[model samples]
Target: MTIERTEPATDAAERTMLEGWLDYHRNTLAWKCEGLSDEQLRTASVEPSELSLMGLVRHMAEVERGWFRKVLTNEDAPPIYYSDEDQDGEFHLTESDTYQEAFATWQAEIETARRNAARFALDDLSEGKHRRTGEQFNLRWIYTHMIEEYARHNGHADLIRERLDGSTGD
Candidate 1:
């Protein structure tokens, strides 16, 4: 994944540490999607691959909901993109959606995540019993993991976008 310097263009400016790393990541993620019209962004790498840019957008939104809202807040909220019957629904891309539809949903979810994250103290803890191990976890772990999760998938998305077009770089 390309990381564009969020630094000010001039050398005289004193740069703050962690300056726009998160914003850089967010913009870089969006930058990978630049210049692709609706149809191209929604295109899949291969038929039946269950990997599409649109799906990644939705999946990341779901992840933010899962970690920041449900897990971080320890709410009993049901999984946003999960299904007990078929676990892979989150991976399935909706080709029928217009560009406006996909992006609008994504924008809404991103806002929700940001709002929830803003509400928490830095040391917030999750109160739920684990689904597999039946243990409790602090929200700290969930937040760290969410950052890692987004970074990792953002790498995957970079490659996908590269394949779509020659415009590559943060």
Candidate 2:
């Protein structure tokens, strides 16, 4: 599948700007993983760190679920790939873990995030609070943070992809 990432509009409204950039980053991550084999997707970049393209997809799926479903909508959405006992379960892939499943789950979470965010204005407070500070967050803040999160992870993805196949771009 071709991942066509459009540039965020410069003259758009605040919400459009935010959503555009967020989706851009989302697509960036997807593009990074494009055309790679299952073994390549599962290959780690460096020693010790278990960061892989597939793992990033799974981790982002969890992030989307946590912020959008569990926090924004206050739904009883448990982690699909992780738990308290194994905080980074998504990053720790098994022999059965596949790119198709990880990407499908991530895309599903993104759809749910869009639906949840559509119900609230940017200034609306999240139904759930921060796990660390116990402070509630506005949708604007959530959007901004999610953009940052994806941006950071996408950088890692870029490196991993480069290491895997020497392909590089935004």
Candidate 3:
């Protein structure tokens, strides 16, 4: 599939601009992984790191579900890729992990995230509290954090892609 990413609008409403950049970073991740085989997707960035494009995809799936489904709506959303016993399960690749399943789950979570976020205004408070501090968060904070999450991970993806086949771009 062809992954297309648009530059976030320079002049737009806050919500529109936020979503645009969020999506741009989302597609940037996809673009970095484009045309690679399952083995490539599963390849780790370096020894002892266990960081792979596939891992990032799975990790983001968990992040989306955690923030949008659990935090935003207080739905009974559980971690799909991790557990209390293995918090970093998403970053650890098993032999059976595949690109198809990882991408499908991530995309599905993205859709759910969009739907959940649509139910609230940017100023709306989330139903869930912060796991670390017990602080409340607004939808606007979630959007900004999600964008930062994607942007940071996308940078890792750039290096991984470059290592995989020397392909690089912003």
| lDDT agreement of model 1 with the native | 0.62
Residues 1-170, model 1: lDDT tens digits: 34353743444322222223444555556666656777787777676686767667667767766665666566665655558985766566465765566556656766776676666555555645556776655645655566567677778778789888865653
In order of lDDT, best first, we have 3, 2, 1
lDDT of 3 by residue, 1-170 (tens): 89998987798899999999999999999999999999999999999899999999999999999899888888888899899999999998988999999999999999999999999999999998777778778999999999999999999999999999999999
Per-residue lDDT of 1-170 in model 2, one digit per residue for the tens?
99989878789999999999999999999999999988999998898999999999999999999999988888999899998999999989888899999999999999999999999999999998867788889999999999999999999999998998899886
* Local distance difference test, each candidate: 0.62, 0.94, 0.94
lDDT of 2: 0.94
Off by over 4 Å in 3: none
Candidate 2 TM-score over all chains jointly: 0.98
Candidate 2, 83: how far from true, in Å?
A: 1.4
Model 1: lowest-lDDT 10 consecutive positions: 11-20
